[model samples]
Target chain A: MARVIVDVMLKPEILDPQGQAIARALPRLGFSGVSGVRQGKRFELELDGPADEAALSDVRKMAETLLANTVIEDFSIRVEE
Target chain B: MARVIVDVMLKPEILDPQGQAIARALPRLGFSGVSGVRQGKRFELELDGPADEAALSDVRKMAETLLANTVIEDFSIRVEE
Candidate 1:
């Protein structure tokens, strides 16, 4: 089975409180030099067939319709060998 | 500023209810051919310096201590150019 990866991230203009919290806690834990952080979602989909153009197109539709809330997030899809 | 990506995924044996839920919904929505789905988290870190060895080391510590729960999850780190 082929694997498709979909990364769904918040829009650049959106505020990510979870990411900010991590950023704030880094220095306290002695891990510094991180200026910012943005949290997102990643999905690994195992397809029943090869990762051809048709499969990619299907994945794109799935990502747009369910995997991401397009009003606030953007998603990118790629096939992993 | 350099960007580092940390991908945190649940262990293969761990239960992923959220991903399963999505997988169940896909076929009903007319998007088929997906055999399995696994959901995870993606974090983008904006570093204050170049993505040198030291910065990567620091990110590894960050991932182990804060970004991932080692018991049931695993994380991978990469530098995004």
Candidate 2:
């Protein structure tokens, strides 16, 4: 089996309210000297076989249809042995 | 300068409600055969110098203070040249 990692993040042009809220709360949370906070999502998938083109295509479709909101976010997938 | 990547995830024992919700919505979103959806956070930081002990300490403090909710999450930091 292979391990697949997917990262989903809001596009730079999109306003990430979640990230903004977290950034605003940082100082109050006792953290100092921190500036940007871009929130994103990570997914780990245990694939049934070798990491191949077909698996990649399925994963990409998964990201587009469910894992990410393509209208506001972008995603990248990484595969590991 | 160095690039630092931080990955934050819900501790295995902790229930990830957001992940669960996303997993539940996947089928409706047209993704089949997706069973798990463990969500996490990623932060990319461009440090002011070569990644050194001091910089790592600062980043750790940031993770503990703001980047992650210690009660439910664990984090790992990776430094890239």
Candidate 3:
């Protein structure tokens, strides 16, 4: 089965509270030298069949329409065997 | 400057509520044949300096120490020039 990886991230201009919370917790956890932390989302999809260009296109549409909020987030897709 | 991409995902045994929400929304968005969506996190870090093996190790530690929750999540890191 084909596997696809998708990444979704908030727009740079947007304030990411989740990322900020993680960043604040880092030093307390004993990690220093880390400056910024932006939180996003990752998705792994296992296709029932072979992944083709058409299937990928459909997935892209899915991402735009439902998987990602285009108004505040961006997404990327990677397909693998 | 060097760039690094980090992906964090929930353990397979963990039920992902966010993923479930997204999966449920797909059919309404006109995407069929899509089954599962497990949500995770992605981080893009711009290194303050060159990225070497040592730096990568440090970043890995950072991920373990703060960026990811070992109890429920796993993470992968990639560095690029």
| DockQ-derived CAPRI band for the predicted complex in model 3 | medium
* Local error of candidate 3 at residue B68 (angstroms): 1.0
Docking class of 2: acceptable
Residue A12 displacement in candidate 2 (angstroms): 1.8
* Clash counts for the predictions, in order: 0, 0, 0
lDDT of 3 by residue, B1-81 (tens): 677778889999999998888778887777767677788888876566667887788789988877789899988899855
lDDT, model 1: 0.97
Q: Candidate 2 chain B: worst 10 consecutive residues by lDDT?
A: B28-37
The top-ranked prediction according to DockQ is 1
Interface RMSD of 1: 0.4
Query: Model 1 over residues B27-67: C-alpha lDDT tens digits?
Result: 99999899999999999999999999999999999999999
TM-score of chain B of 1: 0.97
* Candidate 3 lDDT score at position A4: 83
Each prediction's TM-score against the native? 0.98, 0.79, 0.85
The model with the greater lDDT, 2 or 3, is 3
A1-81: candidate 3 lDDT, tens digit per residue: 677888889999999998788777877877655577788888887666667888888889888877789999999888965
